[model samples]
Target: MSEVPPRAATAAALLIDALRRAGVRYLFANFGSDHPAIIEALAADRERGLQAPAVVLCPHEYVALSAAHGYAAVTGEPQAVLVHTDVGTANLGGAVHNAARARVPVFVFAGLTPFTLEGELPGGRNTHINHLQDTADQHALVRQYVKWSYDIRTGRNVPQLVGRALQLATSAPAGPVYLTGAREVLAEEVPVPEVAADRWGPVARVPAPEAVVDELIADLQAARAPLVVTSYLGRTQSSVDKLVAVAERLGVPVVEYNAEVLSFPHDHALHLGDDPHPFVAAADVVLALDTDVPWIAASAQPPAGAKVYVVNEDPLQESIPLWYLPADHHVRADSGLVLDQILDRLPAGEDPRAARRAAEAAAAGRRIRAEHERAAAADMAAGRLTPATVARVIAGLVDEETIVLNEAISVAPEVWKHLPRTLPGTLYGNRGTSLGWSGGGALGIKLAAPDSTVVAIVGDGTFYFSVPSATYWIAQRYGLPVLTVVLDNGGWNATKRNLRRQYDGGAADRTDRYWVNLQQSADFPGIAAAAGQARGTTVTRFEDLEDALRAGLDDVAAGVPAVVSVRLDPISHQAEDPV
Candidate 1:
């Protein structure tokens, strides 16, 4: 008979080994009383020279999940995150929501309170805190946000449970998955199964059907004006190139709306500005690729006689409860695969009107860009650092290798106007509208793209929400340096605008309206200095913005984290109007 192979002495050891073998490079962790066994197992593995997924200690659960989210966004590989019991899992809800919306793969693991009070297992309850920490349904904390959730039932089920979670996370319509590790289960000894590393890798991406491709091509061929609108198309460099090729070849105008990733070359002749409403209203054939809200229905919609095609791996966007975008043709397949197939099948030569369309689009794009620049200049000359000017100066400073993470909602459209991202993986934003994602997301991007400069452009309101002290300490502790630029508008400007638009001259119009003002701004630079790992600077003058930004960028390039807080003007009533 064949001799039995060795097995991991503890369930936690087997779980860690399984994750490492599954291509996870890092495990962001926030420990608690329930994590002792897993922590010990990790230390033991390190001592045994079996490290692959290095453990990164995070100060908070939100940071851990956000870091994991950012890492997955850049690497295109699912990463692991370990959190404490109920409270830690509760803190992860927002970040998990962001990951779910972004469709980034994250494997989240949380420890459960001990199952026994009499020490039936190696790590069973020894203190009263265990009983208090135990919840009736801990997994429910993140159940709705994740693609799948499980509580490990037995020590022997660790390998299968973990493997299943990873598989679900990396599968089509990828998102986060959660698994709770019972303290007793983690400590119990069981024979580890010999699960193959590739046993549960991402399922193969199937191309779109030939009939759908042909119909799409036929529509493109027949249409006088074609437009492509996307939000999260540029997951890979090849996808970006392929989409660009298809648009240029077909003479289609591409608009990226609320783009979380750089979907197209902004400088391309056929590339339209960020807003899709105008183009969507004009195009005869509208191809919406991977965009959730192609156009706000109340404010804008496709022309009455236009045909719309919506393509995505998950056509319905199941994560979102109330998505009501209209589409005539909903092709459910991998976006990159569909684009590649379209490129392969498109007619050899350009249409008769291709040149004219291209020229007209190019001219319009130039006009739009110029208008934005003029508006920015006007705003700056008025003695305030406009969002556009700040974005433009930063755009001038950054190269193709820089990665920009933006969560400044009010000024994001303005920033995109100045910073024409031409490279894939060079831009990311909050698709889920989470306030504190950028600060932690920037750190994750820096970890994944250590050679590239990572910058987090956030608002003053967002800066406060980001848990600045914890984020900075994590950066310093892990040696991940990212330039953090705070667009200080003195308050929740977006909220203020909404109130004015919704209430008009009602109670909200009063200057003393409750919870609207954040008039007393904190010294952000001083806050950074207190962290001991980051340096900070505050720029109040428009003329000083450039120098301050350059200095902060220099500091980041020198392997130190830096913050540049630029005082922005109040939201202009005419902010949304064209120049």
Candidate 2:
């Protein structure tokens, strides 16, 4: 970066430098045979003391991609990921889907098989495995999920192309982008182009139009019962603040359906519980702000003639093939900016009607809280280690500053009920139905916010899906101490529950043939213990739950990754004749 003229360098080194120039700080990488050129470039850069993004070696593709997703969720800054060829891309699997659904920007690059044959070029194919790995279309694996996919043909424009990829990824309605390159091109040395900083920037927020402002204002002011619903608006702290002001000013109760972050303080008078069904049914006006599915129309819908306003960065959800939500008005702009506009246009004086609505909502909130508390108490009295009790115990162990990642699939509602998230950036959940994102997500969150306590609550099935060995290994190696609570219910409870719900009188249900059951004994604690320098423990009885959870927290506080497996009742099965 001195005044001297730039020199030629390997495409790999230049690409790394490109990421650094683009403000990428870390590269979560899982290497393979195709990455030799990249490895050599990294080594050469190190020898010359040139700056580049820090490479965090990941053993599995799922963890690598999920870690990048988690980091972006907290910081709102896309990170970089490097994986192997098609095989590694296949392994990315559901984690990439999770990233796409969450709208987290990430730069994902993979190595492609060498195009040259034996002895033909410096970085030509050298192994039989290379022949097996080559695909006619490598990007086809994830092309449907990513915003953009490209194969880098030449090294001349590597930096500029990388900048463009990142710019597209970070723009509004952000998501991951894919890039792949062969070894020969990556090893080709070329003069680094003078990078232009201004050309590859993200598009700024598009403000809401003023023409429909008066109509929206009139509807909001006239409605007797208005409601607001959101999912990921809380991803940005300022957005959460703006939403709170606007909702409180209008006395509109807010509900979070499948929320990925804590958008509103749970204790607020206008903060309704997660389910939007009951409120949506009675409301005359509804504002669906930054939510994909405001309500399942079959289960719940607004009154026949309700005034519905759909507002988001992408109100139509163009990425999704079929998004048929009802909307009277569609505002395609930044949700936070729209909230700011609404707050500014409202009258300064408080309305008597708005105050009365707030008071009624407070009563409704109290009822909901009491109902949940009673349910938890009843479960405790049943002498079982229920999800409610597990959630309550974990809730007691964490404070407002702790970063909690919830992937307790069937029992997620219980977790949400017991653990009230009061602050922004304190809680996250996967918007996608991926089973194991939270394991690596906890690591990424810790990496981004090192001072915060990170706790990940995962189901027994999700724990297995998360590739615990790889996740915990990264945690131990990187000095990221995270407390993972495994809610062991013995099997895939969500899948089994759905089966029973749909086939109550069917032969499979009558025979108690729940094929999804994982009846085998699993020592989840031992799995954690296998990771070097990590602590593992188990709790079965309700009485011992608190102590075990506290001990795990203590271990994490002392700088060791810990796993506490809390065993709930196993899935019930009818006795079968001896095989």
Candidate 3:
């Protein structure tokens, strides 16, 4: 005879059970008093030996949401967040957009006043909530951005409904889910089901269609000067290994497209940087996998007779110039699945060109490295805040697990070289040109991997404009800590460079837009401590660098999100104001 669980479990208990069944092990929470019933239920679970929720306190809703995004995206397990009422959701709106754009799966839970429970004074202060009692309308605000949103209605239906929500959140094209629980429903009793054991970790095998593989083999076998371009496929560890294998078999070049992140190690000889225009123009055949196609051939000018092949699930139909480049063929399916197909078809015989081409790429990679070093050394000698040194020091601090969420446009390449990634450890900045995305993303990464230290390497311009106020919540409130390493070089280095390049030898600082160039020296560490009582430090001496990095990581690991501000000399290339 089996014992059935009690019917006295509250909505919180039911919801928590659903998450546990789905293999949820951690929460990135920022609490509020929008509803007492839900709060009390969580408290009761903690008391009754259900195990205290492993919660990471974050500084702001943006940070909380961003951390959740990173955790879910990398781990391939859905992350959880508890947003307050309307105000809290509004504050987190930008970060929510960032996650939605990334297609990362997370559950954004919020509490709205129950229509039945509010006395005469339900809508205390949430202006967006109609009254103290509200409908599920407020919860739907995230629908355009998140995959799904729901308000838990009755207690009796909860245990099952929660499971459905989990399914939707972790499904393919994974994105965030928004759920609301009425205060009264959260208090009501329900028959509890035993927590379902985790049956999913991350789905790794994507079986390629054999028919497609045959066609691809025929197409690839004909390519004279073939090239491989990769995108978001870096989501899985197998991605790098698979892509590397496929490229090597053909003795072809593998380039990372819009490679805002380290898709393949820069050290690989085959890895031509993202802008393969130079090589693509000459390539007899170019294959793009999981990339936004237009970006690979948008200039309306590819080399004559170059054939372009695409492999992706969704062949984007809107505003995409499909005919601009000579379309050789299209395989509409998952990227990993397609790669698996190609691997199966690779011939067993050794490729003579493989060694030679790889050697050439390796040599080229070394030359590029030397050029970068000379440029960095020049900037270091210029006595301005160079982004290179700041990136170098920060990159050296991260191990294989650490993630760097960077938003500096001018110094991205230098940063990539200084701290190249092992497979699947790094995430790129947003592809949409959204500036503040990295600050929120760093927070999201921390929430997702609570045990792993996350660092947001921001440019001085980005920190001052977006992240300066973002850390208050993490440092002062919910205790989830992430170190923000600000690369302060005093101005918009990238923008000025672009402007100077566009205009021949123009005096950029002539207008010197004082706003673009800060007129006053900022006391960054002092400002950081004041914003959220974050332990702050200024790194000026190379001798004191390692210790500062260790201290920051330790504090963040201990749940005290801190900021390390480094002031570097500007790269000397901007002396004439490239902008």
Which structure among the candidates has the greatest TM-score? Answer: 2
lDDT of 1 at 229: 91
lDDT of 1: 0.83
Better of 2 and 3 by TM-score: 2
For candidate 2, the C-alpha RMSD (Å) to the true structure equals 1.7
For model 3, how does the per-residue alpha-carbon lDDT over 209-285 read when each residue is reduced to its tens digit?
A: 68757766665566656677776777765677777777777666776766545567666767766556666666666
Angstrom error at residue 346, model 2:
0.8
Q: Which residues of candidate 1, in runs, are more than 4 Å off?
A: 1-5, 380-383, 510-514, 570-579
TM-score-superior candidate, 1 or 2: 2
For model 2, the stretches where C-alpha displacement exceeds 4 angstroms are 2-5, 381-383, 574-579
- Relative to the true structure, candidate 1 reaches a TM of 0.95
- TM-scores for the candidates: 0.95, 0.97, 0.81
User: lDDT tens string, model 1, 393-474?
Assistant: 8988889768888888888888888777888999998787678988778888889999999988888888887778778888
Q: After TM-score superposition, what is the CA distance of residue 68 in candidate 2 from its true location, in Å?
A: 0.3
Taking all chains together, the TM-score of candidate 3 against the true structure is 0.81
Model 1 error, position 319 (Å)? 2.2
Q: Give the winner by lDDT.
A: 2
Question: lDDT values of the candidates?
Answer: 0.83, 0.87, 0.65
